[model samples]
Target: MGKLIVHPDYQGNGIGTALLKEIEKDNSGLRQELFTSDQSLRNLRLYKRLGFVQFKIKPLSKDLNLVFMEKKPGLLEI
Candidate 1:
């Protein structure tokens, strides 16, 4: 799942979460990875709540960085 985009007007309506869930169902038992801009705190929080862990942060430039997160809900090990 690339970018789960819900228009600004649809924000807070669970649309993005639903989309992510569907993709997760399709991928069933695989680990998924995605990146968001460092400044997007809202998205970061949502991803974290969905069980994604921030494994690294890549600096894109002097003022921008990418937050790389991953999730493997089916995995039983830490």
Candidate 2:
């Protein structure tokens, strides 16, 4: 999946989590991978909470980097 952003007004309402769960359910048995900015702590936490692990990091500039995360097949509990 690509960027999953919930509107700020609707943030913290489980919208992002539900979308991710649906994606996982649809792609069962396949590894799921995505990337986000290192500066996005909230995104990082959300991804980690959903079973994604950091497997790589790509530097973009002095103050920016891309964090690559992946969830192994069968790791989804919901």
Candidate 3:
């Protein structure tokens, strides 16, 4: 899966979680991965909450970094 962005007006609803769950359902039994900016704390939290773990951190610049995260197959089913 790629980037996931829920509209700010709809923030705090279960949109992001639901979207991730759907992706998980579609790709059942397959490993999933994604990356997001280190500064995006909310995104990081959401991904972690859904069973993704940080596997890498690549620095883009002094103030920016990419956090790569992944979830193993059958790890956490919604």
Candidate 4:
């Protein structure tokens, strides 16, 4: 449950990666989940590379879909 946002003028400089790394560093051994629009392909790829897998997808509106993803780090899946 965290938010990471870098101003449009400051993007593409690894700010988002740094933020996620720091958060994941202080919070290990627990499953982490996040939600984003299906249209966010960049975010989808980033999450996948970070070990998150699609947990579910639910319709948000007639023109958009929401994607739910989760990562367990080094923990076992129940």
Candidate 5:
């Protein structure tokens, strides 16, 4: 998972949601994942709102101030 970028002029307009919906439609079983830099709080919140849950948090080894946060679907209860 990597950072997704929307043109500055097109952001805050639900484009991201549309993209995610399309992705889901194309691959229903894919384990969607994303990694957010420490500075991206807004994106992090949006992911949470869309059913993604945090699975890992780690600091960037070279940059103490930078962190890597990953999110994906939770395990199913069998």
Candidate 6:
């Protein structure tokens, strides 16, 4: 698991892509997972493009939706 944060000024600069690729390359035998709110449509699209798929969706509050996503390199499912 990892957390990546990008400043508004750094958006669309590929920083997040670089970090995600590096982490995926360095980790083996373990699937990666992350969560985001429904509001982050850009992030949601980016994550899906990287092969992460939504496994769960839970409500955290009346105005917020939590989406749990996961990615696996092999046949193993989590």
Best by TM-score: 3
RMSD to truth, every model: 2.7, 1.6, 1.6, 3.5, 4.6, 3.5
lDDT of 2 by residue, 10-63 (tens): 978999889988998899899999999999998899999999999999999999
Worst 10 residues of 6 by lDDT: 69-78
Q: What RMSD does model 1 have? A: 2.7
- Candidate 1 vs candidate 5, lDDT winner: 1
Q: Rate the local accuracy (lDDT) of all candidates.
A: 0.84, 0.90, 0.91, 0.81, 0.64, 0.84
User: What would the per-residue lDDT of candidate 3 be over residues 1-78, giving only the tens digit for each residue?
Assistant: 446789999978999999999998899989999999999999999999999999999999999999999999968633
Tens digits of per-residue lDDT, candidate 4, 1-78, equal 566677889877888777777777888977789988999887887778777899999998998999999988794332
Residue 1 deviation, candidate 4, in Å? 3.3
TM-score of each: 0.87, 0.91, 0.92, 0.85, 0.70, 0.86
lDDT of 5 by residue, 22-69 (tens): 775676666776667656777777667766667766677655334333
Model 1 TM-score, all chains together:
0.87
Choose 2 or 4, whichever is better by TM-score. Answer: 2
Q: After superposition, how far is residue 62 of candidate 5 from its true place, in Å?
A: 8.3
Q: Which ten residues in a row have the lowest lDDT in candidate 5?
A: 69-78
Question: Candidate 2's C-alpha lDDT?
Answer: 0.90
* Residues forming the 10-long window of minimal summed lDDT in candidate 4: 69-78
Give lDDT tens digits, candidate 6, residues 1-78. 556888989989998877877888798657889999999998998888877899999998999998999998763322
Q: Over 4 Å off in model 2, which ranges?
A: 76-78
**TM-score (C-alpha) between model 4 and the true structure:** 0.85
Model 6: residue 10 alpha-carbon error in angstroms: 0.6
Stretches off by above 4 angstroms in model 4 are 75-78
